[model samples]
Target: MFIKNKRVTLLSYWTSRYLLTLMIGLLIISFISALWIRHTTLENRLEMIEFMAEEMVNRITDVSIPGIPPDERVPNFAEDRFRIRDMNPSMYIINTDGEVISSNLPLEQREQSTFSELINEKEEIRKFTSAKNNKDYYAVKKKIEIDDELVGWVLMVESKDKLTMVKQEYGQLAILIVGLALLGWWAIYFLSRRLAHPIKQVAEAAKQVQSGNYEINLSDHIKEKEVYELVSSFKQMAGRLEQLEKTRTELLAGVTHELKTPVTSISGLLQAVNDGIVTGQEAEEFIRMALVETSKMKTMVGDLLAFNSFAVDAVPVKISQLDIDNFMKDFLAQWYAIQEQTDIVIKIHLLHKEVMISVDLIRLQQIMTNLLTNAEQAISGTGEITISLSEKEQYVSVIVKDSGSGIPPEEQELIFERFFRGENKKYGIRGLGLGLPLSKMMAQSIKGNLHLVESTEKGTSFEVLLRKEG
Candidate 1:
């Protein structure tokens, strides 16, 4: 069905290999058949012709025609007794003077002396001979006696039917083989498509699976055993597709819950402002809330984009040397108001010494902000949130812990997946699902990682690891 060109399709679809194999097979079979038939037919014809030539020679001597004397006449002849023209003689009878007296094939068989010369040879001669006139003969010349004295000779001339008929029959066989080969071309085309039908069905079924149908019913199409194997393999692949679809659905629900909260809050405050419910101080507070929502939206967008860039293996990293203690101090200064508002008891544990390492500043800030936001959400009413840093021989690690409702053991691993929120956490109050996944992605991008270290019903701690500067 490819529309590149009609002639191209005709050749490509059937393919020369099968056609060639079919052609060669048919050729060999047909050739043997035709050759045997032709060979047998011509051999039978030659045997019959040889018998007739022998009979004709015998008839000429035994049965003498009218106006012919038997005894004193030339006792020999050339050409068969069957006269060329019955009205005259068809054989050449030689006289005592070695001259022709009677001839049936007058122009050709008149060579009675030549027959006499052949018969006089030493060994008994009985073979076909060709004339100087390009005519051939299958004659048997023998000694004929009259009154016990040799007189003349006899020659039997037959046309070259042995070679002629064989050649003609061969032409007919050539035509038959050509016709059968043409038929073989059509046979190969249908056969090739029949063989490829199963492959095509598997491809079409896989396409339907890609269109999100996990339940692929391929019972009717896959009939042959070979085709069924491919179909079964596709069915197995469809199973994995089903699991991926379920994961995608769960991710969507989590993302929606995460987005709906901040959007709802922003809309409520904006609607209040529009209705002139509060002004002056209240208006300023609403404005600040709107800014906070805007900032939240911005963070969500950044997380999603940065995670995608990392997934594609293209996130840029600008590592620098900075004191980890000073970075945390600056980060706490920015979030001091949020901790105070939530009445969250905060504690920082780090050495003031310079903790130089390879890091991306903006990327680290994003990870810390997401972690702190998550920590703040976990603590509903005045609870302790601790930030602690430690350095290993070859890596730097930052740990954030919250004294709030920790993650369930079952949900601990899934929490880092994109758009996956915990079931027990309140959707309206908790951080968006993008935060942890984004933090994990950022950590891995700088040759680091993020993991939930330990969790219980009372608290959760998240660990971030980064390579120390070279």
Candidate 2:
């Protein structure tokens, strides 16, 4: 066999066509979720910073130090008094007039324009980045009221840089997406291979059949129902092909032997008479034997021709209502005379006084004659043959039973097949095995059926069903 060029594999094709696209979609979703988390985290951190700054202001104004004078309160309050004051190391305190009150950050980091903007804003807390240093900051400004009169405002500032936190979240999400993609790759490969296995097996089996090898063993270890059915159908076809090959070989051998024997015998008989080896009464007897052989050959040829006609649907049947009881009486009389020397007793049992059925007269007689002949040949000695006629609702049945040795169990089904002669050679059976097949075809051409009703060591019975007259 010539090999073709290789193409893309099923696993890679499915992954590229579907799995990769799905992984990319999931990655996009993960990125968007990470961004949302970063935004929400930043907002929460800013709120926490503002709350801490307000607590510090309340402590400073109340002067929690025991004996600190008013002038020295701003500078003399111990830094150790406030625990939350150290939450933001870059903290700042400014008054309402935009003047710095106290601060941990240097003056260079503070922008006066930003402080002015914060004071004019209606909101209590606002966020902005310093223009000079590019550092992000959140500023919270609160008004200090003493005796129902507004005093100075307290402005608190904290630096807001969340690059490290955002980067950490993004890294975690990237790792998760990567892990899921790896798992998806394995899943896609397994499913794709599973789906493609049956097709591959079928292709391989076809190749073997093309190469004249019909012996194929296919596995039933498949889960998919459709694939299993396909495999089963292929196996059945292969089995049928194998049987056909065997049947053809048998047919060729049988044809060669059947034609050769009769022609050889006739040729020898004629040559002996021509050479004057026998004379008078002996020559006449030899001629008679030759004529009988010739007749047998002619009958075989006629059977073949009839079978060929029926195979192509050329056997025309003219159907009409037949008087079945009267027909069988005449038919059995003819067969009785034909088999008189064989000591076969033929009898008829008519259950109905009169039964009319729709059938082709000539074809019906031919089928019955063939069956009777087979029964006659099967009898090795004295035997009884019974032909029973019965009627059903819409059909009539003719059953032929014989007291001869019954057909073997294994050979019963094949008996009706063309060119199938069972092991009955001991009785000197001379036929091309077309009798039953031709009879069956003739029966079917007139819309009827022939079947073996039962067969045992004692006897064998065959039944024929035909449509009855309306």
Residues 1-470, candidate 2: write the lDDT tens digits: 86688587766788777776877788788878887877776676566656656665665567745321133344322354332332443454556566666655556765567777787788887778788788876777776555545555667666665421566667888888888887878788888889778878888998998787999988888889998999998988887677767776886687778878899999999999999999999999989999999999999999999999999998778999978888888887776666646677888888657778899999998999998888877777899889888887788889999998899986786787788777774226778889999999898888889989998888889999888887
Q: After superposing candidate 1, which stretches have Cα over 4 Å from the reference?
A: 1-244, 253-295, 313-315, 348-355
Q: Which regions of candidate 2 are displaced past 4 Å?
A: 1-192, 220-240, 391-393
Candidate 2 residue pairs in backbone clash: none
List model 1 lDDT by residue over 116-145, tens digit each.
555555533344455566666444344434
The alpha-carbon deviation from the true structure for residue 307 of candidate 2, after best TM-score superposition, in angstroms, is 1.0
Q: What TM-score goes with each of the models?
A: 0.45, 0.61
Q: Model 2: what TM-score?
A: 0.61
